[model samples]
Target: MSAVPAMPAVRVAEGPVRIALVGSPNSGKTTLFNALTGSSARVGNYAGVTVERREGVLTGSHGGVRILDLPGTYALDGETPDEHVVHEVLHGAVPGEPIPDALLVVADATTLRRSLALVHEALALGRPALVVLTMIDEVKARHGRLDPLALSRHLGVQVVGVVGHRGVGLDVLRGFLDDARNWRVARVPTGIADAGARFAWVDRVVHEIGADVLAADTRSDKIDRLLLHPVAGVVVFAAVMVLLFQSIFAWAVPAMDAIDTLFALAADGVRATLPESWLVGLLADGVIAGVGSVVIFLPQILILFTFLHLLQDVGYMARAAFVVDRVMGRVGLQGRSFVPLLSCFACAVPGIMATRTIASPRERLATILVAPFMTCSARLPVYTLLIAAFVPATSVGPVGLQGLVMLGLYVLGATVALTAAKILNSTLLRGRVSVFYMELPPYRWPTMRMLVRQVGQSARAFLRRAGTIILAASVVLWVLLHVPQAAPIAGATPAETARANLEASVAGRLGHAIEPVIAPLGFDWKVGVGLVASLAAREVIVSTLAQIYAVSEGESFRGVLEAIQADIDPRTGRPVFTLPVALALMVFFVFALQCTSTIAVMARETGGWRWPAFAFTSMLLLAWLGSFITYRLARFLA
Candidate 1:
C-alpha cells in the first residue's frame, strides 16, 4: 500500500532556492520557523493583499536558501483569504512570487490524523517535500506511539520529528535541508483529489501505525475547567486586566524618570556647550524635549506589550476570545470578529485587514466601521500624560486610582465600539452572520527568549517612530512658536519673555483662532495647539505639548508632568490644566480619529473614501460632545 521511494534529486532554480512552510494553526509551525531562522526573518505585506508575508534565510551555512512561512490554513478549499492565497502561492499564480522549490508540511504529532489530509493536498502539488512533526515531546510524554519511518513510507516523503522549543532534531533537519541538490518530489497517488479517498488514506495510516495521540492532556483539561467557566472566566480576565494596567504605572515609574533625567542632562549639555541662539533653542527645546517626552512613555509601552505577548504565548488569549464570543453575539457580530477587535488594541490597520476572515460582507463592514473605537497603543502616550498630571496616585483598595482611570478609558472605548456595532448591524449592514468556530490552544509555558524578542521588536518600532515623525513635527512646531520673536518687556523674566513670544507667534495665533470654540471644554490656547497637531498622529500631541511647555518654561526638561503642571494663566491667575480640563482631554482622545494613517488604511480596507469619511465625521462630532459633557459635569461636581 506504500507509495514509491525517492528518485534522483531535481535541479532547483538558479537564484535563491525557496521552501514554502505550510501548516494548520496551533500546529507549532511558528515555533519551528522561529527556531530555524531566529533573527534573520523579514516581514512585509504581500504584493496585492494585506496578509503578512514572512520569509527568512535558512540557518547553518545554507547560504542562499530562503524559507517562506505561509498563513496558517486548515484546508486549501476554504473560503478565507488566507486559504485563497495559499492555493495561489502553491500554483505560482501570485504576481511577485515564484513557485517554491519544495514544500515543508508541518504537523502537530498529537494531531497527526487530522493533519494527514493537508499532507495529501501538498503531495498533489507534485513538489519536493519534507514533513516535520512538531510537539513530539508532548506525544512521548503522553505515552503515544509514533513511527516516522512507517509514516514516511506510506506518504512517500522524508519525515523528521522535532521538539521546536527545546531545539531537538533541528541539526538533522538542517543537514537534510542543506542537501537541496538531492531533494526528490513526493510521489502522488491516483484519485488523490477525491475527498473520501484522501481521508480513508489518513484513517488507514493511523490504524496501521497506532499513531493516534493520547486523549487531551489531563493537566490542560483540569485547568480549562476553571478558566473556561462561564462565570469565573470573566471575573479572572477582568482581574488580570486590572493588574496589567496597575503594573504599567507602578512598574514603569523608575525607568520613565531615568529617561526624563537623561534627556534633561543632554539638552542642558547642548545649551551649555553652544552659545544661546535659534539653533540651541531648536535642539534643546524642540528636538530633545519633544522627542524625550514621548520616549519616556516607552517603559509603559514595553510593559503593555509584554503582558500581551506573555498571555498569547501561554495560550490564554484564545480562552479569552472564547469567553467573549457570547457577548459578541449579543452585539450581532460573529465570533471571528472578536480576534480582530482584540488586535485593535495594538493597532487598527491590521485589525481592519483581519476582517478578510469573515465571509459575510455585511458583518465584515460593520467590524471595520467600529474598529477605530478600540484603544490602540498609539493612545497610550496621551492617556498616560494626562492621567499622571491630573489623577491622584492614591491606592483604591489594591489598585491605584491612576490605573483605575486607564482601565475605565479602555472600557469606555470598547463599550462604545460594541454599541456602535449593534446599531450598524441593525441599520446599515443588516444581514445574517456566518457560522463561527475557534480552536482553544493547549496551555504551554511561555519561553523567555520569545518574550524578549517580541518586546525588543516593539521597543525598536516605538523608538523609530520617535526618531522620524515625532522628530519632524517637533522641529516644525518649534519654528511656528519661535519666529517673529516678541520684544522683551521692561520687567519680564526670561520665562515670561519666552512665554509672551510663543503667544504672539504663528502657532500661538493659530491656537487662539480655535480657542474660542474649545473654551467651553475648559481648554486654553496651548491645548488647542496640541489638539490640532495630534490629527497627524495620536502620539504627536505628547511631543507638541512638550515643545510648547519647554520654551515657555525656559528651563531644563524636569519631567513633562512637572512642566505641564507649572503653567499659570495670566488672565485668570490660576493653573491652566485643572482636574476637569485634564479629564475632558482624556475623554476627547478616547473618541477622536486622530491618526491619518488609520484613516488611510480605512479607505484601503473599505475600497473607497466613503466609509472612512463617514467614520471620521461621526467620531469627530462624538469626541467634541464627549469632551464637553465630561468637562461640564466634572466642573459642576467640583
Candidate 2:
C-alpha cells in the first residue's frame, strides 16, 4: 500500500457539509443512514435495492450535515443501475447535484473480507473517507475480534464500529464526524490491475487488523438448520405467508367497517341537508363513494406493510430467499429476485424499480416483465369484494374459506410469474444464470419507531394515490355515466331514473361495445367499463363500481355487495354475479396488467416502449385466457 499526498482542505461556506453513504447490498448501510439522519428509508434483510436517492439533514454539535443515502451496490464499476448512480453522483455527473464533500463507506463486520473490495474502491476516489463497521455486535456474538483503532492506523483512515439498529457507539461515531478536518483520503497502489489484485491487498489488511479463528454463530446456524432445511424451510415460509394474508382479512375488517360507516353517515348528512340536485349527487356519489371505496382498503394496506417490515427487520427475509433460490434458479433467476417479486404485492411500480439491485440484465428484465402478476395491494379491494359477495365464509378446519381463497390467488400469481420467467429466460431474455450469494443477519426485535415510520410512509403513499389518480378517474366515470340523459319516465324512482340515464350514456355504450368480447369470461357491460377505467389504477375498479352503483341505489359498501349479489340478468333472469362470474372476475384481476402507473414505470425502467408494450399485451392476453378457463370450469361445476 502506498500513501498519496494529502489534498488541500475544502470547507463549506455556510450550509451543511454534504456526505454520501455507500455500501454493498445487505451491509447495514440503510440502518446506519437511518440512525445518523433520522430518516425512515425502507430497510430489508434480503439484498433489497433502493431505486430513489434519499437525502436527510443530520444535526450535531458541528451543526447540520447533509447526508445522501445512495443505492447499495457491490462495486463502483457501474455493473448495475444503482452502481452507475453512485458512480455518477460521486463524480458530480448527476444533474442538479453537487459532489459530496466526504464519503462514509459502510461495511458489515461479519463479512468484512467480502465488503473490503467496495471499501477499497471508495477509498480510491480520493475524497475525504471514513469506514463505519455496522453489525459489530453480530461479529462479537460469533466470537470474532476486530480492533477499529488498529484498522484505522493500518489503512490511514478513521474507523468506527457501531450497532446501527441498537444505537450503540453512535456517539463516538458522531464525535469523529463532528471534526471533519481529521478525515483522510485513502491512497491506492497505482499498479493494481484487476479484482484479484484488489482482493489480495484486502486480504493483507484483514490479516493485519482482523483476528483469525473466529467462532461460528451457533444460534443463527441452529435456526438456519430448521429455517433453511429444504422442506422445513419452505413449509415455514408458507405458514408465515398464510398467516400474513389471513390477518390482512381478519384484522382489517373492523377498521374497514368503521371507514364504511363514517362515509355512509357523511353521505346521508349531505343528502338530508341538500335538495335533490346534480351537485348533491356528484358530491355523494362521485367524490364520497369513489374515494371512500378506495380509502376503505387503507387498513389492509397498512397491515400488509407492517408484516413485511417486521419480517425484514427480524432478518427472516434472507432465509426465506435462500430457501426459494433453487426454485428461482431453475427459472433463471437468483435469490435476489425474491425480494422484488415479493414487493410487487404492494405495487408493481416499486417492484419493477427494485430490479436495479439485480446484477444480471436478463434476469432483471425477466423479473420486471413478470412482476405485475404478483397480486398487488390495488387488486385487494376487487378480490375482497368478489370473495365476500360469492365465496362462503365458512371455516375449513383451521382456516377461513375466504382467507384460503385469498391465499390461493396470491399463490396463483407466484406460479404464473415463475412460469413466465422460465418461458422468457428460455426464449426472449435467455442468458447465463448468475450465482446467488447472501448474508443472513442475526434476528432482533423490530423497533416500534421503525415499524410505525414504515407503516406511516406506506399509508401516506396509498392515500396520496387515492386522492389524486382515483379521484380524477371517479369524476370522469361519473360524468360518463350521467351525461346525455334521456327524459325521465313518469312514476319512476330516482334510482330507476339514474339507471335509465346510465343505459343511454356514452360510458354505457362503450361498455356494451366491449361486452361481446368479454361475455365469454362472465363479465357484464358494467364490469367492462370498470375494466377500462382500472387501466389508470387497479383500485380504481373499486371506486368506479362504487360510483356507478351508488348513483342508483345510494348504498354503502356492504349494501352494494348485496345488491350485486341480487342483480338479475335481463336475458337469463338469473343473478348477474353468480359464483362462477365472481370467481372469474377474481381470476381476471389476478393476471391483468391493469395499472397504468405500472406500465409507465416499466417504460422508464426499461428505457423504451418495447418491453412495457410487450408486458402489457402478454399480460392482457393471459388475463383473458385465464378468466375464460376459470369461468368455464366454475360454470360447469356450479
Candidate 3:
C-alpha cells in the first residue's frame, strides 16, 4: 500500500524556511549538502582555501527545505563580499534574499578548535545554529576522540556527527529540523570573544570531553611523503597532466570522428537530393556545416572534463595547487590560483570568474587579465585541424611525437600566461603576493555519479556558450562571406557559383583593402578574410578557410588544408602560411583575448568596463608583438 506523503511544513514570511550550510574551507560542507539533497554537486577548492557558495534543494524523508552551501569562511566578521553576504543573510540585511532561518554550522571533527571559531562567531548573532560535526570518520581514525554531545552542550546548540560522503547523520540532522525550539542563542562575554579567548574556550571543551574523539589518520602526511617530494612530485604531476591530455584525445576521438562523419554524410545527402543552387548551398554549407563543425569538438571537451572531475572529486586537486604554488607565486598568484588557472586550459571565462576567491583585487585582476593567454578548448578545433595537417608525428623516443607537440602547445600557453601575469603585476596591476593557506580534504574514491555530473555540467556550459556566441557569430560570418552578392563578370562562372562572386562582396573588398597590412605577417587576402570572419568566433576561422578554399564546393577540411599548403602569395609567390606564419598564428592565439563573453563577464564582475578594456588592449598588443616576433624570428632562423 502506498503511504501518504507528509504535509507541508510551516512557512516563514520569506516564503520557505531557508537553511544554510556554513563552515571553514574544506570542512566537507558541500559533501554534506550532496548527501542531504542527493545533489550531484561539483566540488572543488576555490582559490586555495577560500570558499565559493552553491545551493541545492533537499526534499526527502524530511519536509522540503532549500539548502545553500555558503562559501567556507574562517570567520563571519569581514567586509569581504562573500563574508558580507553571509552576515547580511543571517541578519536579514540583503534585500530580495531570504534570511536564513537556521544555520547548519559544519565543523571538521579533526580540527574542532579551528572549525568551532565560525560556530562561536555565529552564536553571537543569537540566530538558531546547529553544529554539524563533519568528517567524523577521519576524525575518529586520526584524532582519537570527539564528544559531539558534550561539544553541543558547551556551545549551547544541538550537534550531530556526519560522515557526509558515506551518508551518515541525515536522519539526526533532519530530526532537528522539525524542532527549532531545541536550538538556542548562547550569550558569551565580550572578553571571551577575542580570537585567542574563543580558541581557548573551544580547546577547553575538547579537553573536558576526554578521549572519545578519534584522531584523524595521518594519511595526508603519508600521501604527501611521495606526492609532495620536490623532484618526484613534479615528475608525477607532469605524468598525470600528460595522461589527462592523452585521455582527452584518445577517449574522445572516436565520438568526434563519428560526429564529423555523420555531418559529412548529411551534407552529401543534401547535395545529391537538391539541385545545385545558392539556397541549397546555404542550407548545407552555411547552416549545417557551420554548426556541425563546432559540435564535433564536444565529445573531446566532455572527455577532458571527466578526468578533471575525477581529480577534483578525489581531493588531489588541492595538492595540485600546493605543488604548483611556488611557480604560481612568481606571478603574484596564490596556490589556490592553480585550479582556476588550470581550468583556463579548458576556457578562460570560468577561469576568470574562479579568481573571485582571491582576496587581493590586484592579484585577482592580474590573473583575470592574463587568463586568456592560456589556450582554451575552443582552440582545440583550430589546433587539431592545423597540427594534423601540418605537423608530422614522427617517433620521439617512446611517446607519440604529435602528442608531445600538442603538450608543448598547452605548456607554451601556460608559460605565456604566467609571464604575462608577472609583467602585468609589475607594470599595470602590481600588488602584494597573497600567502597560500588551504586545507587538504581527505582523499576518497570518486563516485561515478559525481564524475558524470561534473562532466555533464562542463559540457553543457561549453555548448551553451557555443550556442549563444558561436552560433550567432557563425551566422553573421556566413552572411558576411556570402551576401551583397558580387555582380557576375561578363564571362565569369555562372551566378549560381555564389562563392566565386564573394570576392567582390563587401566582406571580400574589405579583406582586400586590409590584405596589405597583414601581408608581411604572411597572411593573404583569404587568410585576412578568415581573420575578419574569426572576429565573430575563433573556430569560425576553420569554416571560413574551408569556404575560402572550397568556394566552388562548400566546407571541406581536406580541401582547405590542401589549398593552404599549395597556395602561393600573388605578390611574393611564397607559400601563404609558411612554417613561420603558422607558428606566428599559434603565438597570436596564445595571447589574444578573442572571446566577447569573457569581456562582458569581466566588466560585470569588476563593476565597470575599464578593466575589460584594459585587458583587451593589453592582450591585443601582446598578441601582435608576440606574433610579429615569432614570425620574424622563425623566418630569420630558417
Candidate 4:
C-alpha cells in the first residue's frame, strides 16, 4: 500500500475544485453529484444495487475540481463494507488516498430523522462537512418546509437546499466549499442522553426548520406510484429485460460480423506473409484463432452493458429489486441480494463485491456461494454459438423463439442458484436475522462520460482476464494438443504426423484412459482432453474442440461446426453430441463454477481459501450430477 500525502495534493496549476459528496442512501447524494459534476460520471446499478459510486471533474472559477459520489448509508458505524469505505475516506485511512478538503452531505428533506443519522456521524469525524438538504421539491410538494437558518444554528453546519437533478442551489453549495474553514463539527448537547436522544434532536431540528410546507402531490411520489405499481411495474421489468437481451442479439450482430471479418483478414494476411513454420502457425492458428474467437464477442459484451447502464441511469434498478424482493426472500435471500444477484448476471466478481451491502455475514456468504451460477458475459459466446447451431430461429408468438431459449438458460441458472442457496442456508450457512433496507433512488439521465467509463472498465476487465490466465492456459493447451510424436515411421507429412504423435504424449493417454468414464456423458477422448485443458477456462473448450476436430482438413468456422455436428462413434455409428448430449452440456454449463477469476475473487473477498474451496467443490459436484441426469433423461426419452 502507498502512503497518503501529508496534505491534500492538487495539480500546481488551478484545476476544478476537488469536492466529495457524501450522503445516506437515497438522500439524493448522487443526484447532487450528477448535478454538480454535470452528470459526467457513469451511472449504473453497481455490484450491489444498494450502493454505487461515481466520480467526475467539475469546472470551477479557481480550477478543475475532482468530485466523488459515495454510496449512501445511514451511519459510519461500519456495519457493511460500503459503510466501512466511507468511514475510511472521511478519516484519510484508505491507502494512498487523500482526505477531501470539503464534504457535501446530501440529506432527504422529508425524512429528516433518517438522514440526520449520517450527518451526525460525519460531524463526529471532525471532517469539513456541510449539510445539503435534497428533494426540496419533493418535500415542498408533500407539504414539508425546512428553516435553513435554524437548522444550521442547531446542527452547527452550513445548510443549503439543493434540487440536484435540475441544477438548483448548486452555486450556494459551491460558494460554501470555496472556504472550508467555515465548516465545523456539530456541537453535542451538554450531557449524554438515552438511546432516543438522537431521535429527539432530529425531531427538534425538523420542528425548528418548519418541516411542513404544502399538501400538494410531489413529482417523485406521483412517478413512483406508476413505476412501482405491482402489476404495471413487473410488466415493465420483463419488457426491459426482454429488450436488453434482444438488443444484445440484434444490435451486436453486424458489429460482431465486422470484427470477425477483420480478424479473419488479419489471420490470412499473416499466414501469407510469414514462412510456414511453427512460429507462424502459433500466431495464425493457435494464438490468433483462439484469442480472437473470444475477443470478437466484445461487441455483444458492450451491447449487454449499454442496456445495463441505461437502466441504472433511469433509476428503475431499485424498483426492480423491490419487485423481485418477494421472490428473493422465498429463496432465503435478503431483498438486498437482488442487486448482487443481478450483478452476477454480468460477472460474479462484482457480484461478490456487491455483497458489501448485506450487513449479515450469513446472507453475504449465501450470496457469494450462489453468485457464480449467474450467467456471466464470458459464457455468452459459447452459449450463443451452440444455441445458434442447434436451436432453430423462429417466432414463439411475438417473441423470437431463440431468445426465449436464451432467457430460459439465464432463468435456469438463477433457479439453480436460488435452490442451492436455500439448501445451504438450511445447512452450512444458516443463522442470523437479515436486514433488507435500501433506497430506491430517483432516475437521472446517464451522462456520456459515465457511460464511456463504465463500458471501458468492463472491456478492460475482460481483456485483462483473457491476457493473463486464459493466454497462459491457451499456450499450454496448444502444446498439450500439439506436442510429442507417437512415431515418425511412414510417408506422412509433418503437418499430418505431428499431432497424431500427440496421442503418445502424456495428456492424450490420460484423456484416453478417462474416456470410458465420461463416454456415457457423451464426451469422446478428445472432448475429455479439452475438458482437462479447460480446467483453466470453460470458454477455451470451444477453441480446443475446434482444434481437436480439425484433423488435417484445415480449420474454418463452418468446418469446425460441421465437424462437431458430424462427430459419431465408430462403434455405435451414432452422433457424439446427440440432442441429449447437447442438453446435458447446457445444464452442466449452467451450474458449473468454471471461471478461475471468480474463484480468485471469492478468496480475496472472503479473506481465505475456505470459502472458495467450498464453492468449487459444491458447484462442480452439482454440475456433474445435473449433467449426468440430463444425459440419462435425454437418452431414455429418445
Candidate 5:
C-alpha cells in the first residue's frame, strides 16, 4: 500500500458556490442530491439517462449552496449525449449556465474502482473537488469498510461517506461541504495512456484506504444465479411482466370503479340541477363523460408506475436488460435499448428522450423510431375499455383472459418495434451495431419514502396531462359534437333530438367523410370521428367515444358501451362494435402513431420533420392494414 499524501490548504470561492454533482449511473448521486437539497427529483435504479438536468439549493448551517445534478456519465468524454451534457455543463459551454465552482464526484463505495476512472477525469479538469462515497452500507454488507479520511489523504482530496437513502452521515457530509475552503484537487496519475493505467491507479487508492473489501457470497449473487440463468432469467422476466400488466387490471379495479361511480354521480347531479339545454348537455355528456373516461385510467397508470419504481429500486430493471440483451441484439438493438423501450410502457415521449443514452446515432434513431410501438399508459383507457366490452373476464389457467389480452397487446407492440428495428438496421439506418455495456448495481431494499415520491411524481404528471391537454380536447370535442343543433320536431324525445343534433354537427360531417377509409376496419363514422379526435392524444379516443355516444345515445359510459354493443348498422341491419370490430379497434390503436406529443418529441429527437413524417405515415398505414386483417379474421372466426 502506498503512503497517503497530505492535502494542500486552499481557499474556497466566495459567495454562493455552484457544485456539479457528477457520477456514474446508479451511483446514488441523485440520492445524495435529493438529501442535500430536499428535492424530490426522481431516482431510478437503472440508468436514468433521459432525465433532464436538475438544480436545487442546499441550505444548511453553512449557508446556501447551489447544487446542479448533472446527468450520470461513466466518463467525461463526450461519447454519449449524457456525457456531452455533463461535459458541456462542466465547461460552461451551455448558454445561461455557469461553469461549476467545484465538483462533487460521487462514487459507489462497493464499486469504487469502476467509479474512480471518472473521478480521475474530473480531477484532470483542474477544479477543486471532493469525493463522496455513497452506498456505504452496501459496501459494509459485502464485508468492506472504507475510511473516508484515509482515502481523502491517499487521493489528496476531501472524502466523505454517506448513505443517502437512509440519511446517514449526511450531516457530516454537509459539514464537509461547509468547510469548502479545505477542498483540494485530487492528485491522480497524469498521461493515462489507456484504461489499464486508470485501473492500476484506482487499485492503488483502494489498497491505501483499506477499501479492498473481501468478497463473499451474498443475497444478490444468490438471486442472480436464478434470475440471470438463460432459461430461468427469461421465464422470471416474462412472469414478472405478466403479473405487472395483470395487476394493472386486478389492483386498479376498485379505484376505477370508484372513479366511475363518482363521475356518474356528478353527471346525475348536473342533470338534476341544470335545465334540459345545451349547457346541461355540455356538462353531463361532454365534460363529465369526456374527461371522466380518460381520468378513470389514472389508477392503472399509478399502479404501473409503482411496479416500475419498485422494480427499479430493487435493481431488477438492469438485470432485465441484461437478460434480454441477446434477444435484442438479434434485432439490431443493444441491451441498453431495453430500458428506454420499457419506459415506453409509461409513455413514448420519455422513451424517445432516453435513446440519448445509446452511443450510436443509428442505433439511437432506430430505437426512437420504434419506441412508440410499445403500449404506453395513454393507450391504457382504450385497451381497458375495449377489452372489458368485448373480451370475457375468464381464466386462462391462472391468468385472467382479459389480462392475457392486455399483455398480448403489449407484447405485440414490442414485437412490432423489434421487427421495425431489424428492418431499419438492415435498410435506412443501417450501420455497425454497437456493443451494449451496463453495470448491474447490487440490489437493495426499496425504501417507502422513495417509492412514495416516485409514485407521486408519476401521478402528478398524469393528472397534469389530464387537466391540460385532455381537458382542452374534451371541451373542444364537446363543442364540435353539439353545435349546429337541428330544429326540434314536436314529438321527438330529448334523446332523439340529441342524436339528430350530433348527426348535423361538424364532427359528424368529418366523421362521414373519413368513414369510407375506415370501413374496411369495421369502424363507422362515429368511430372515425374518435380516431380523428385522438390525434392529440391516444387517451382522447376513449373520451371522444364517450362524448360521441353520450350525445347520440344520451347515456353513461357503461350505457354507451352497451349501446354500441347493440348498435344496428342501418345498411346491414347488424350490430356495430361486434367482437370483430372491437378487436380491430384495439389493433388499430396498438399500431397507430396518433399522439401529437409523441410526434413532436420524435421530431425534436430526430432533428427534422423528415423522420417523424415518415414514422407517422408508416405507422398509420401499418395500423390500417393491421386493423383490416384483424377485423376480417375475427369476423371469419365469429
Candidate 6:
C-alpha cells in the first residue's frame, strides 16, 4: 500500500478554488450540486451510465469555484469501490486529480444523526469545511427546529440550512463560497478517535441544537405503506410498468408519425431530384430508410427515459428494490442484486458495474452474469417493431394489446434472469446471499430542470449510438447487399429483377448459408442476415430490416411494415414474417447474447473471458430453445 499523503494547509490557490462535496447517499448532495451548478456538470472517462465522479463550476462574480461531487460514501474506510474513490479523492491519491482545497459536508435535515458520523469523518481530514443542511423545507414542514448558529458554534465549523431544489438560502451559501480564502478551519475534537466517542460527540452537538427527527417523514411512510407492502407493492410496480409500456406506444405515435413522414418524403425527394444511380439508391434506400426506421423509435426511448428519471427522482425505486428483496431471497440473491438488475433496465453494462457494491464475490459475479438478461433500451426498437406489426393496438380495458405485449416481454426478461440466477446459485455459482441495507429517501416532486437535464443526457447518448455504430453498420450492410450486382434478365419485370439482384448479393448468400440453422425458429434468410447484423447493436436489426425490406414501400412509414407482413416465401407458400415468426423473433431477442460491448464489459468485470464465453454460449442456446418453443406454440394455435 502507498503511504498516505500529508494534509496540506488551507491556502489561496493560483487557480480556481476546488471544493469536494462529501455526504452519505441520498443526503441531497446531488440536489445541492445541481443548485450550485446547473447543466454545467460533466462526466469523464467511458461515458457509460455507471459514472461515479462529476465536476462542475459554480460561476459567480467573485470567481469560479470548481465543485467535485464525489461518490456518496457512508464512511471513509475503503470497504467498497465508491468509498475507496472517496478516500482517494480526499487524500489526493487519485491520479490526475488535484487535492481539494476545502470540503463541503452536505447532510439531510431530516436524517442528521447518522449523517453527522460522516461529517465527523470528513472534518478529520483537516480541510476547511462547510456543512449545508439540505431538505430544510421538509425540516420546517415537520415543525422541527434547528439552530444553525448553535450547531456552528459547537462544531467550530460554519453551518447553513437550505432547501437545495427550491433555491432557498442559496445566497448565503454562495456568499460563503465567494470568499474561499478566509473560510473557517474545522477544529477536530480531541481524544475522539474511537467510533463510540466520535458519535458521542455527534450526539452532544445534536442534543445541544435540539436536532432530531420529527414527524414529517410520515408523509413518505404513509405513501410507502402501499408502495412497500409485500403483496401490494409488487402489484403496484407491475401496474406502473404496464402503464409505462403503454405510454411508450401511446404517447409516441404523433412524433413517430411525423418522423416517418419526414423520412419518407426525404427519400422520395432524393430519388426524384437526384439522377437515378447507385449513389441515389445508397442515399435514399441505404441511408434514409435504414437509419430512419430505427430513429422513429426515438420518441419511445425518450418517454421510457422520462419515466425512469421521474421514478428515480421521486424515490420510489428504492422501495421497489426493497419489495423485490423477498423474491431475491427465494432466488439465493439479495436486494443488492435487485438494484443492479434494476439498473440493467437501462443497460447491462452499468448494471454489471453496480455489482461492485456487493461484498460477496460469488454473489456479485452471479449478478453480473445474469444482468444482460434484463431488457435494456437497446432492445426497445426491436420489440416495438415486432409488436407494432403483430400485436393490435386495441385496448384491453385501459391497456393496449401492444403495451401488454411490451410489458410481457419486459417481465419475461426479468423472470428469466431471476431463474437463471437461481440455477447458477444452486449449481456453479452457489453461495450464501448477503445482507442488504438501503436508506429510503423521502418522496419529493421532481424538478423539471433536473428532469430535462437527465432526459437530455440519455437522449444525446442514444443519438450518438445511432450516428456512430448504427451508421457504420448500415453502410457496411448496404455495401454487402448491393455489391456484385446481377445483370438484368431480358424479360424480367422490375420487381423480379430487384429480387434477383438482392438474392445474388453477398449478404443474401451469407444469410442463405445460415438458413438451415435458424429455419426451425420460422426465420428466413433475410432474418438470419438481420440476426447476424444486430450483433453490433440490437437496434441495428431494425435498420437491417429496413434496408432489406426497401423493395416496395408506398408511404415509407407503417407501409414498410405492412409490406413486410404482406411478403410471401415461394418455398413455404406463406407470408414471410408471419405472427408466429414475429413472436419467435422477439423471444430470440429476449435471450440472445448478441452485444459485443456487453461481452467486453463482462470480461473486464470478471477478470477474464471465461465467464463471458460461458454466458454467451448459454444464452445463445437458450435463445434458440425459447424461439423454437414460441414458434411451435404459435403455429399450433394458428
Where is the poorest 10-residue window by lDDT in model 1?
Answer: 550-559
lDDT of 1 at 503: 71
267-374: candidate 6 lDDT, tens digit per residue: 999999998998998888777866775577678767777876787789876676677667787887776676677767766655675575564456687889999899
Scored by CA lDDT, what does every candidate get? 0.80, 0.78, 0.71, 0.70, 0.79, 0.78
TM-score list, all predictions = 0.80, 0.81, 0.83, 0.77, 0.81, 0.79
Error of 2 at 20 (Å): 1.3
- lDDT tens digits, residue span 1-638, model 4: 36865443445223444566778766777657766656356533223323344677664633356777876667766566667677777777766546776787788876786677667666665666788998787666566667777788887888898777666788888777666544776664533244377667766766666773456455557778887888887888678766765676578779878987887777788989988876776676567666665576677667666666666667776677678778878878876687677767656665676676565566777898899998876677667766766666889999997798788889999888899889988988665445567667655666776677556766776676656655555566666665664777588765446546556656677679889877777777876776665555677667666656644434534655677788888988977776677777777788878776678667756766788898888887887788899889978988
Choose the strongest candidate by TM-score: 3
Off by over 4 Å in 1: 1-12, 190-197, 230-232, 332-411, 421-435, 483-492, 515-526, 534-586, 595-618, 628-638
- State residue 405's C-alpha deviation in candidate 5, in Å: 8.5
Q: Which structure is stronger by lDDT: 1 or 3?
A: 1
Q: Ten residues in a row with the worst lDDT in model 6?
A: 43-52
lDDT of 5: 0.79
- Quote model 1's TM-score: 0.80
- lDDT tens digits by residue: candidate 3, 1-638: 25755433433532545677878767888678877766534333223223355666664634356677876678887645556667766777756656777788888887776777777887777778788988777765674777787777677778899887777787888777655434666644444547888888767767788733554457767887888899989987888777775675577778988998898789889989999877776777666776676677677666666766687778777777778878888877776676667666755666675676565556676777777778777677677766776667687899886677678888888888888778877876654433346666677888887677557766776577667765665566667777777656565554334456567666777788888877676666887777777665567677667656653454456777787788777877777777778877777777777666577657655667888898888877777787788889988998
Clash count, predicted structure 5:
0
Residue 269 CA error for candidate 1 (Å)? 2.0
lDDT for position 317 in model 4: 65
What is the C-alpha local distance difference test score of candidate 4? 0.70
